[model samples]
Target: MSKVVLITGGSSGIGKSIGEFLTYKGYDVYGTSRTPERYTDSKFRLVALDVADTTSIKKAIQTVVEGSGRVDVLINNAGAGITGPIEEIPDVEIKRNFETNLFGPINVIKAVLPQMRLQNSGLIINITSIAGYMGLPYRGIYSASKGALELITEAFRMEIKDFNIRMTNLAPGDFATNIAAGRYHAPVTKGSPYETKYGSVLKNIDEDVDNGNDPALVANAVFKIINTPYPKIHYKVGAFLQKFSVVLKRILPDKTYEKMLMKHYKL
Candidate 1:
């Protein structure tokens, strides 16, 4: 039987691309969405899932397992984005972002682990962000949430190693997707201290996303990871510079890297 792949937030964007590509590669693919009915044209099967809700996560996993008999891969691709100066961002928004990006993925993993252990074999991929490797201006909350997930995946790997289960973090740079439309933006308040700089940085961020590489690149990476016998703990898929940024942080002094980011963001 073909490998059964389950992807959360797979109704569109990178999740959709992965689902379609894996389907073409002969895998049994199932994608999740908060409103599955909205994606009538999705290439692979889409089940209802709201990562923030524990009950919904359990039901979605059960649905896929019942339909496919097994889930060989689970891609935690569902996440939300938030942008604002850290101080200006509402506490509620910060919690909401974490709920979707960090806590949600954790709960989904918890829901899937029992089944994965029963099968004695599985792969779990968490979709993180290139920005997760560092703190980015106007996007600190997003950075922290994704970065936390990256670390969690590392810890999870060691804990599940004996079960024949594999886990990894795939951090993608800006991809041409509707993520910008979905992201929450703290309003550029009139005459506020951060209005001018925040507005400028926000515009740059959106333009980067608009001109980002095709989502297919990430899908290809995911496919590669699934087929590999011994996958690494972390894989980054993006433009050379974006991937290199992570390396640069490792080698450069803290202040120097901070300066580089400031110059890049015109902060």
Candidate 2:
């Protein structure tokens, strides 16, 4: 039987690519998005969803469950970028980022776990980012949210491993996606502070992302992982050059890692 997959933030970018790729692989993929009309995939269904809204997330999951007998894979691909100095960003903005990038995944995982436990065979892929492993300038909140997601994935995987429920955290380094130019409205007035410190870092981030890995590449990676016998705990995909960055994260101490990041990001 073909697998049934649920993908969040599947309207565009990496999520959309994953949905399409999975469809080709014969999965009845259901994607969640606020703009469902734009996502017209005959092989995949698009349902209205706002990850920030728990009720909406629950309803979407319920709808998918109703349509399909089971959801075999849950791809937590719904996330956005909110970049600015930590101090400069407003508390409300931070909360919003966490709601979308962190709690959103948690909500989806919670909604799906019961059924998955009963099935005893399922895959949960969290679309975390390289940011989950390291902190970058001007992306404090975004990084913090993803960092939390990494830990959450770890704990959840441990809890569900006995049931053959696989939880994989796929962290892409710099995938070409709309997240670099995320549509976040600034809640604060004229620059309060942190402009000078974060300006260059943000510029570099924008530039690198603008010319980063294609979304389809990560989509292919996602497809490949689902077929793996023992899904890896962590999968890091990035441009060839970013290999050194991951290596730096592995060998260097925390403080030294920061310096290496500064050098790579040109901060």
Candidate 3:
């Protein structure tokens, strides 16, 4: 039988691309959405799921496992983006982003572990962000949430190794997607201290997303990871410079790297 794969937030964007590509590769693919009815044209099956809700996460996993008899791979791709001056962004919004990006993925993984252990084999891929590797100016909250997930994946790998299960974090750079439309933006308040700089940074951020590489790149990476016998703990998929930025951080002094980011963001 073909491998059964479940992808949260797979109705669109990178998740949709991964789901469609795997389907074409002959995998049994199921994608999740808060409103599955909205994606009538999805190439793979879409099940109702809201990552923030534990009840919904359980229901969605049960739906996929009951239908496919097993879940060989799970891509935790459901996440929300938030951008703004850290002080200006509402506390509620920050928590909400974490709920979707970090806590939600954790709960989903928890829901699937029992089944994965019962099967004695499984793979879980958490779709993180290149931004997760560092603190970006207006996107700090997004960075922290995804970065936390990255570290958690590191810890999870060791804990689940005995169960014949695998977990990895795939951090993608800006991809041409509707993520900008969905992201929460703290309003650029009139005469506020951060108004001018935040406004300019926000504009640049949107343009970057608009000009980003195709989502198919991320999908291809996901496919490769699934087929690997022993996948690495972390994988990054993006433009050369974006991926290189992570390496630069590792080799460069903290202040120097911070300076480079400040210059790049024109701060």
lDDT of each: 0.96, 0.83, 0.96
Ten contiguous residues minimizing lDDT sum, candidate 2: 183-192
Model 1: residue 90 alpha-carbon error in angstroms: 0.8
TM-score of each: 0.99, 0.92, 0.99
Off by over 4 Å in 3: none
- Candidate 3: how large is its RMSD? 0.6
lDDT of 1 by residue, 150-173 (tens): 999999999999999999999999
Worst 10 residues of 1 by lDDT: 10-19
Off by over 4 Å in 1: none
Q: Write the residue-wise lDDT of candidate 3 on 212-248 in tens digits.
A: 9999999999999999999999999989999999999
lDDT of 2 at 76: 96
How do these models rank on lDDT, best leading?
1, 3, 2
* Candidate closer to the true structure by TM-score (higher is better), 2 or 3: 3
> Candidate 2: lDDT over CA atoms?
0.83
lDDT of 1 at 265: 93
For model 2, residues 107-211, the per-residue Cα lDDT tens digits are 989888888888878999999988777676777778889989989998989999998899989988887778755646343335656555466666677788888
